[model samples]
Target: MSKSEEASQRPDTPHYENATGGWGSLKGVSRILADQKPTFGAFRTLMRQNKPGGHMCTSCAWTKPAQPHLFEFCENGAKATIWDLTRERCTPDFFAEHSLTELRGLSDHELEKTGRLTHPMRYDATSDRYVETTWEEAFEGIGAKLKELDPGATVFYMSGKASLETAYLYALFARLYGHNNLPDSSNMCHETTSVGLKRVIGVSVGTCVLSDFDHCDLILFFGQNTGTNSPRFLHTLKAAKERGCKIVTFNPIRERGLVEFADPQNPAQMTVRPATRISDIYLQVRPGGDIAVLAGLCKRVLELDAERGSTILDRAFIAEHTTGLDELEARLREVSWEEIERESGLRRDELNEVAGIYATSKNVIGIYGMGLTQHVRGWLNLAMLVNLLLLRGNIGREGAGISPVRGHSNVQGQRTVGITEKPENVPNDKLRELFGFEPPQEEGRSTVDLVEGLLDGSVRGLVSMGGNLARAIPDRARAEGAWRGLELNVQIATKLNRSHLLPGRATWLLPCLVRAEEDMQATGPQAVTMEDSLSMIHGSLGRRQPASPHLRSEVAIVAGIAKATLPPNPRVKWDEWTGDYGLIRDLIEATYPDKFKDFNGRLFTPGGFHRGNAAREREWKTESGRAQFTAPEALTALGAPPEGQEITLITLRSNDQFNTTIYSFSDRLRGLSGPRDILLINPEEMERRGLSEGQVVTLECAVDDGAERVVRGLRVVPYDLPDACVAAYYPEANPLIPVSYRDELSKTPAYKGVPVRIRTDEAGA
Candidate 1:
C-alpha cells in the first residue's frame, strides 16, 4: 500500500490565487466535463481530440497549430481526453471483485478510478487475484517469460504513451527478442533534453518550430512552467504577446502559469481584455539556479562584447559555426559577480537586465522545462543554455531556435522511433540496413539502469510499454522495491496504475487501445504515428471504437508479443507486421530514411512533415564538425543548507496533473483542493520556519548515498516561494527524491532540484 501510503493528512485550503487562464481555464474545463459524465459515446469521443480527423492529445507536448484549431483540446488536453474516455470498468468481474491485496490500498488516483483495463489478466499465484487471461494464454505466458530471461535479463520500459507504431514495433520486438533493453519515457523526462541537446546543438531534438514561437523577437523561459506545464503553452505565450514578443520568465515559482493566461477560447478573457499578460521579465531563479542564471547571462554577453560600440557577440557566428569560443571566453571570466549573485537568486542588476533582453534580440528563442532538466548539473543546465543561445547567432536562422519545452506527447516520438538505451550510437546503421538483424550491440538499460537492475539482481524482466513505473520512479521505496523485485512483469496498459500493483513472479495485465480508441487493425482501420514537440510527424486517426472489445492495440499488443516470441522470422514479418500499420510505416521508411521520408505521404500533409532539425540546417553533427562551446563550471549552490534551515524541493504538475496522470485532486491552477498532501512553503520561509498557514510539515530528504528519504503528512502552503524555496506535487513529492538522485550526465531524476527539511508533523501529530 505504500508509494508513501498515497499521501494522507489531507488539507484542502485553496480559495483562488493562481491567476492563470480566465475563469481558471473555464474551471479546468468544467472539472473535466464534470468528471466525464459523458456519452453521446463520450460526446463523439470528445470530437476526436486533436482533430485532423482524430486522436493526438496524449496530453502535453503542445504542437498542433499550423492552421488547425477547432478546439484542439487543452484543459490538460481536456483532462487527457477525459482521462481516456472513462466510463469506468476494470471488468472480468472487476478482477472477480478485487484482491491483489485489495488493489494495494487504491490511490494511484484510486487505481486510475478503477476503470478501463478490460481483459488479458494473469497473476493467480494461488488466487491473490487477477485471473481472466487468454489472448492466446497471454501471449504464451509472455513468451515463456522471454524464454526464461537473460538477454541481459529483460527490461524494455517505453511508455511515453507508445505509438510511433508502438515505439517502432517495440524496438523491433526488443531487437528481435535478444534485448537492447530499450528503457524510454526518455529515460525519465527529456534525457537531459536528449543528452544536453546532443552536446550543445548537433541534435537531440528541439530546434524550434511551432512557427518558432511566432517570429521570435525575444522569448526566453528557462526552466519553464508555461502556465502549468504546457497549458497549451499559454496560447503560444498569448500569441507571442500579441506579436511584439519579448517574454523572459525564468522560475522559482512566480507561476500562475507564468503570470496571466486566460484563453478558454478567449471571451476577451471572459468579458473585456485582460488575461494575456505572460512575462516580459519575471526571473526568480534559485533552485539549482539555472547554471547561475546562465552564467550571468553569458557573462553579460561578454561584457557587452567588450564594449567597442558594444556589439554583443556573434563574431561571425563565433568564428564560423562554433567550437569552444576561447574556452567560452575563459569560463565567463572565471565566474564571480559574487558567484553569479550566490548562484542566481539573480541580480548583477538582474544580470544586466537579462543581458539587455538578450542583447537586443534579433530573433531569439530558448524555452525550457523540468526546471532546466532535473539537475546535478542537468547536463550543465543544458550546456549553460547553449551558452546563452550561442551568445547571439541564436541557433539556425530566422526567428531563432532551441525550444525543449517537452513533457510527453510522444516523448519526442519515443526517442524518434527507436527508444534507445544507447545502441552504441543510435540509428544502428539504419537498424542494420532495414532489419536484416545485427542490432542489439549492448550498452542498454536506462531508467537509471533499470532501477539499478532491480536492485542488483541483474533485472529480472518487465515489459511496461506505457509507464507508471511504480508511480514514476525517483525512489518511492526504491521504486516500489525495484518494482517488487521483478521476475517477469509485463503491463502493456491503459489504466490501473501503481505499476499495475507490482506483483511479478509473472504478473501480466495487457489491456491497451486508448489514443482515442478505434483501431480496427487487420489492415482495415488503424492510424497511429506521433512525434510532436515540434518535430511534428502527426497522423493519429483513432475515431473512437474499442472501449473494450477485449482492447489490444498498442500496435496489437506489440504485435501479439511479436508473434508469441519469435521462433520463425522471414527477416521480420510478425504476421505481415500485425496486418499492416502500413507495414509498420514501411519498416519505418526502411529504418529512418532521412527521418521517415514520405512516411505514408506525410499523412496528407496538413501540419506534419518537419522532423528536420540538425540545428535546423546549419547541420553540424558534432565530433568536431562544429557547434560545441561548452565551458560551464561555477554551479555555486543548490544544497549547502546548514545555516538556512534547508528547503529546496520543486517537484510539480498539479494543474490537473499529466505525466503519471491525476486529472483532478483539484489543482485549479494551484488553488488545490481535494489534496495530494500539499507543500509550497516560502511566505518568508514561513516566517523563517516557525511555520504556519496550514502547518503539518515532515519532509526530510536523505541523499548522500541514498535511502531514508522521508515525506509524511506535509500541508504547509504559504508560497510565492523563494528563500529556502519549496513546492510539491508529483506522484506526491515522489517520495522525497533519491532513486539515486541523478543527472550523471542525463540519467534525469533529480526531479526538479530537491533538498528537503520541513519536520514538525512528527509522524502526523
Candidate 2:
C-alpha cells in the first residue's frame, strides 16, 4: 500500500507522531545543535522572519520592521513566517483538480499542500470545487446572502491577530448591518479575565504598563508559562530579574523557561555561559486547583497580619476603594486548611512562604495567562487574584496590579478598537456624536454563544477575521460540523487553515496583506497601529513587498465589504476611510480623546505611547466609586472521574504551536520531537492504571454528551504531574471537551480540564 493509503487505513495513525515530545526530550540535542550550527550567515534570514512590519503573520499580530540584520524569532514564529512565504499557491487549477468532499477527507497537512490562496475563491457545489472569483462579486454575494438572513442570524467572529484598524472597521461594519453578534477569540481565552476585572475595577484591561514592570519590586506569576507561549515575555522577565525584582511562579509543570533560560540577546552571556535564572520561587500547584492555592495564601496573609501586627492588609485603600470586603473575608476564613492542602497539592509551609513574599514586598505585580482562565471556574480564579491584589492595595499603584499576559501582540488592542459584543460601560457617546447612529446598548453573543448558535442553526452566516475557528474551539468535530451549516462563510486570512476546509454552503476566502508585507495604497505605504499588552499603541509599517498584488489590506477589505453592502449609506463615509488608515485614527481620537489624544502624532513617536489610566493612580471607575469585592464560594470541587475512567485529561498547547496553527511537528522545549501524540501522566496515576512510560493506550472521553471520540495508541510518559491528572496536547485532545462544558460567567470551554478513561489497546489500533 502507498504511504498515504497505509496512513488512511491505520485507525490509530498518530497525527504528527514523530514530533510529539517536549523540547528537552527531543533526540540528540547535540545533533540538532550541530545541524543548526551558530552562524551569523543564517541570522539575517532568520531575522527577516522576525521582522514585524512586513506581511504580518495573519495568525498573530506581531509587528516589526523587515530589517536586514538578524533579530529574534521563536520556532513557531519562524513557521508562521515560512507558512506565509511558502512557494506553493492554491490556484484555480489546483481546486479544479480536487473536489471539496475529497479535500475534506485529507489531513490538515495535505490541505495545506494546495498552498497560498492567490485570489478570492467561492465554493461552487456543482463542480465540487472552489472557483476563482473577483473580490467585488464575492463581497456582493456575501452581502446579498446576509441581507436575506435576519440580522441576528449573522455572526461576526474576530480573531486576536486582527489589526486594531481592521477590528475597528469590522466592528463598525457589523454594527451598521444591525447585529451585535461580535464573537471573538477573547471569548475562548480571556473573556473571564476581562469580565471579572471590569466588574471589580470598572476596567476590562490590565492596569500595569510595560514600564510598570521596571518599577515592580516583586513579580508573582500564576498558572502562566511565559517561555513557551510568549517568548517575548522572557525579555521583560529577564529585565525584572536583573533589576532585583523577586520572581515567583505558580504552575503544575516546572517549565524550563520559568526556571532557567539562555539569553539569546546577551552577547557576554551567550559567549560565556548563557544560563539565566527566571523564577525566584516555583510553586507546583495542582491542575484545576488554583483557587485552593490562592485561598490558602490569602488566609495565611490574614493570619500573619493579625499575629505580627503589620499593616500588610491595606485598610485605608480597602475601605475607600472597595466594597463587600466583609463577605469576602468571611469566605476566606471559612476555607479549611485541610481542603486547601488536598486541592492545591501544596503543604502548609509552602502556602505560608508564598504569603510571606506577598506581605514583605512593597510593590508587587501578579501576571497570569490562559492556564488560570481555561477552567470551569476561571472567572472566580481571576476574582481571587484581584482579591489578593485589592487586599494589598496593589492595584492603581506604581508597579502593582493584576496583569493577564495576552497571547497575540494586539489581542488587547482589538478589544480597545471595539471588537467586543459587550456594550462599553464608559459610553462612547462620541460614536453617536460622530456617526449619527446610537450604538446598541444590548450585550451580544460571545465566542461560546457563536458556536452554540451555529450548532443550533440560529446563526446562518459567519465572517471571520484571521483565525481557524474550527480548530481553535474545543470539541473540534462539533465546531467543524456546525461550520458547514452556515449559509455564508467569509474568511479574511493570510494562509489556509483547518477552518477553511469546513466550508459553508457559500464560502469565500479573501486573501489579505500580511503584517510583514507592505500595505501600499493610493496615498502611499500605510502604517497600521497596534497596542501591546502594556496599553502602548504604536504604528507598524511593512517593509517587505506585498505577497501578491491581488492581496488587500484588512482595512480595505472591511471597507470594501461595508461599501458594497451598504451602498449610498449616508451614516458611514466608507469611501474616505477606505483609502487612508489615519482617518480611522482620527475617528478613534474623537471617540477616546482622554487616551488617544493626537492619535496619529503619538503613534509615530518611538515605542509609541501608553493610554494613561487615571484609575492607575487610584481613581475608582466601579459603580460604587470603589473596587467591588466578588464573593465566590469554593464551589463543589470538580467531581471525581467516572467509575470506569482511570484519569482526567487536560488538553494543552505545545511551545511550537499557537492556538490552532501547528508551525512545526516538534515541540522542542518540552523534550518532544517529530511528533505530538505523546501523553504526559503522573507516575503514580500511570502505576495505578497499570501503564508504563512509552506504553501505548487508547483514551476515551467520558463527556455528558453521548457521542464517543477516541484518541488511540497514544504514548504515555510518566511525569511529575499531580496524582489523577494527565496532560495531552490540544486540538488532538479537543474532542474530550464537551460543548456544554464551560465557565458560568465567561462561557469559555474548559479546555484545561477534561475527564477521560485510559486503557491498553489490545490490538494497538
The number of clashing residue pairs in each candidate reads: 5, 36
lDDT of each: 0.76, 0.72
lDDT (10s digit) by residue, model 2, range 337-396: 898898888788878877898998988998988778877788788878888888889999
Worst 10 residues of 1 by lDDT: 2-11
What lDDT does candidate 1 reach at residue 130? 84
Q: Could you give the C-alpha RMSD of every candidate to the true structure, in order shown?
A: 23.5, 6.8
- lDDT of each residue in 530-628, candidate 1, tens digit only: 888888888887777677888878777787787887777667777777777888898888777888887987773667778788788878788887888
The TM-score of candidate 1 is 0.35
Q: In model 2, where do residues sit more than 4 Å from their true spots?
A: 1-79, 424-428, 635-646, 705-710, 759-765
lDDT of 1 at 666: 78
Candidate 2, residue 714: CA error in Å?
A: 2.8
